[model samples]
Target: MPRVTIKEIARRAGVSKGAVSYALNGQPGVSDATRARVLKVAEELEWVPNRAARMLSAARSETFGLVLARTAKTLSEEPFYMGFIGGVESVLSTKGYALTIQVVPDLETEMAAYRKWSAERRVDAVIVVDLRVDDPRVPLLQKLELPALVVGDKSLAGGLTCVWTDSTTAMTEAVEHIAELGHQRIARVAGPPEHGHVWMRGQAFAAAADRLGLTGTVVHTDFSGDEGASVTRQLMTSGPDRPTAVIYDNDLMAVAGLGVIHELGLAVPDDVTIIAWDDSTLCRITHPTLSAMSHDVVEYGGRVAHHLFELLDGAEPAAHLNSTPKLQIRGSSGPPPA
Candidate 1:
């Protein structure tokens, strides 16, 4: 038996080879009626178009790139991104698209990878995360003509479609909740300040403390459990008025903070109330289940992938979808000293 080709389909369908190629590739050129006829005859003939050949001929990379400005080890170990990226892959897989992922040490290395991959036409679109205030990636991505979805800071300008969670609002509410529970002095265990999401949350924690006439201090760390424990001890021992409430940027740090509290002979919620962002299952299984601001990371990833597909389809990306974080109260919060 002989294999069929687009040329054979064009001959049988009484259309030009270009028309058959356009119709089969789903590229716009042939009319709908012509496209249907070409497809119908090709299906009847059991002709399957060579995807690789068509990709090259049509200049379609058919891959969504994710350039991580962190190490692969960090990404694999972090639960937040594991869940989020899984969700993105869930959507991309259905569209017959593959994720072209890369993790680099710094912004410079990550930027270089994006440039190299994009210049080589290895990816159709890229998802940019960890955006900062006045992010350099926004303008650079625009210049590259690489359709991108930025996962932080809706306020970011320069035509990048933004998808973000309301971390600032979540932080303010978390702080206010602790203060209302009679916690006066509060401390925050923050991720790096360069991350836009972390900065927003930290700023909100500070602003909310100021507005409520409370003292708020922050400690920035690398979102590690060990660092979290160390920072918690530093804050607890350094101050005359030790904080009664602590907020962590991630669950790993929150867990570490718990260990620090125990080591210092402090009790949970009784001696110090703990709250964390990026809520995950780790918070639930802790000695005293943690109170946290919760958002659907899996669903958020799917939304991002959906937007990426829309961009690839030549539609202007939709308006940003801001995920709202809700307070999940548990055993970790209580009223302070009477």
Candidate 2:
């Protein structure tokens, strides 16, 4: 049977369209008797809310939405994104769904996009990333009854199904590797503190350094190469207690730091060792071939998307632990200079 419209309900209920609307929406304009009559007619005609049409039709919108709160510059240069998106598409393509991405300036705009998509019925589900502690999107998305896959630990997911990596283990391993290589002092050029993963890594780094009897500090950055270079310059040129090893949050920043080291006539793994969190092709092709905590980012993304599909099928999937990034030693990391 076709979806019953308000006009049909009005005709069958012997009421005007406005009265039908008022009755269906529980507005006060309609009398009690009229409201009952309208509801009865709606039930008899099998009328349902517009939002339920897709469910009853057993047809998906065939679109999944991803709203990014990153700048265009970051999006353009970030190698991680290409691999992740490729993996998501690998899954979505087989399922006949298209991924729609929107880049927004901040969390506000990102949330607004979700609202617009929900109201317009532009997507059947959405993927959320960059979760912060006490994230506001959790409650709002739940209220909208939108299916969402959170791309971070459950600490920020507010009980939503999630796929997360063991960043704490990765960060700790990086520090332990450097420590084993005789790096006494260490620092991290970390992403914004508001992000849950960044905070987890920061905490893990400090804990690992403490356990190994090393000094560790973290400085926040916007995950840009320029910012990474500037931070590297400052840390390397600082006081006598300056770090002998530095960890970067991404490959781009690590590469930028390498350039800064070169300009300062410093040698990697001798003057100061470096480790990058993400091991991309860029990490492999760099001059010194940066040491990194390595994982298959594309496969990680694919796993996340897979969980989202489960959620769409009414499986309230539990939080998933993908895997910890293993430390891959390379030319850029070694013992501190004698």
**Among all candidates shown, the one with the greatest TM-score:** 1
> How far is 53's C-alpha from truth in model 2 (Å)?
9.9
List model 1 lDDT by residue over 77-153, tens digit each. 67788888999999988988899888888888878877887787888889998887788888888888888899986
Kindly report which residue stretches of model 2 are placed more than 4 angstroms away from their true locations once superposed. 1-58
Each candidate: RMSD = 5.4, 9.4
lDDT of 2 by residue, 1-338 (tens): 58789888898888899999999988899899999999999988888787666556655778899998988787677777778888898998898889999999999999999999887778888989889988999999999888898889977788888889999889888988988888888999999999999999988988999999998889999988889999999999997888999999988899999999999898987889999977989999988889998989899888877888888889975789987889999999878878
- lDDT of each candidate versus the true structure: 0.85, 0.88
Global CA lDDT computed for model 2: 0.88
Count of residue pairs whose backbone atoms collide, per candidate:
0, 0
Clashing residue pairs in candidate 1 are: none
> Residue 186: error of model 2 in Å?
0.5
Instruction: Give the 10-residue window scoring lowest on summed lDDT in candidate 2.
Output: 51-60
